[model samples]
Target: MKDTAKHQGLRNQLVSLLEQKGITDKNVLEAIKKIPRHLFLNSSFEDYAYQDKAFPIGAGQTISQPYTVAFQSQLLEVKKEHKILEIGTGSGYQTAVLCAMGAKVYTVERQIELFKKTSVLFRKLGIRPKYFASGDGYKGLELHAPYDSILVTAGAPIIPKPLMAQLKIGGRLVIPLGEDVQIMTLLIRKNETQFEKHEFGEFRFVPLLEDKN
Candidate 1:
């Protein structure tokens, strides 16, 4: 994918907008500035990539809005080499952002088509997550348990218990919880059984799909 100076300029503008909108995490903003968001979408929609909007990526999924990505990333308080489990790989844009910040990300995608497509894109962009699995988001990857942070990119009706259980004590889980319009919820693991909950404003996202088979 060709990332021209114009595209970089657009990303700079987007980062400024994110900052004005209260995304103060410098690393998060830097990742936003560095990643070529346009390369994550189909070439035909390249013009719309840098805007703070979601666009269809196929298999009934949309890449998350830039602000949403930044908000979730900032909430996670990602540290370099932190282990992160991401639900809903989608367009792989979120995965790339986590990777950019030096987190070892293990991402799950329920839609095989999107999973495969995004895997190819990650390779092309030279963005490598720690692991990629085509599986259920609700069933967080237990093989690599106790992540420092977990992020769910889709709208969930409830906090997936498996995801909550997988977090290390003091770990953060960022999810959009609802069926129609999601309330951005942050759950920080307080102990083996208790979690501290906080809510941000409302956001719209594609439903988190469960495997039928």
Candidate 2:
């Protein structure tokens, strides 16, 4: 009962934060609510898990801010049956939210240590995504090609070609693109050979590396 109450309170707080920031997608909001954010963090930072700020999770990488996670997820426009690909698996929080929303997620993480920890957390949460790989996220996941939606959690100087090739027609990819300064851009695969692009807003994230682990 205490655990249920804690989750409920976290949900309320998260919904309030999203609503305040104009995250109007009800499905996205519910997914973010249902996932236990506290479980993704170290116990020392669990109390602040619901806040709209990033927290360090060792290895110098931080779990993304909640609003950023919700905002990127809202852009994906995920449905119950969409096959989603996430390019980074930091702490697996966003992956948890994606699975909670009923999407079959295929995620990749470049950092082996982080990937291992995050994968264990996913198992502990009992949320089994379709695929989890510790490799080059810049290449995206090809085994599950032509994804309904793609999300890149790390910042890149430019859109990665392999990632572009993995998008299905009518599918959309939300990514943070730029070098030192970054803009969160959404790329929609309009057809077999054309892509429509739009910028969501300015944002900052760790650089998307090309090395495969």
What TM-score, over all chains together, does every model reach? 0.99, 0.95
Q: Which stretches of candidate 1 lie over 4 Å from their true place?
A: none
Candidate 2's residue-wise lDDT over 1-213, tens digit each?
A: 024687778779878978999999999888887887888888898778888889888777789998999999999999997999999888998988898899999999888889888878777778898999888988888888989999999899889899889999999999999887689999999888899999977987878888843
Candidate 2: C-alpha lDDT: 0.88
> What lDDT score goes with residue 164 in model 1?
89
Q: lDDT at 175 for candidate 2?
A: 95
Tens digit of per-residue lDDT, candidate 1, span 20-101: 9999999999999999999888888898998899999999999999999999999999999999999999999999999999
Query: Best by lDDT, which number?
Result: 1
Query: Which pairs of residues collide in model 1?
Result: none
The lDDT per prediction is: 0.94, 0.88
What candidate 2 gets wrong by more than 4 Å, as runs, is: 1-4
Query: How big is the positional error of residue 46 in model 2, measured in Å on the Cα after superposition?
Result: 1.2
Root-mean-square deviation of each candidate, in angstroms?
0.7, 1.7
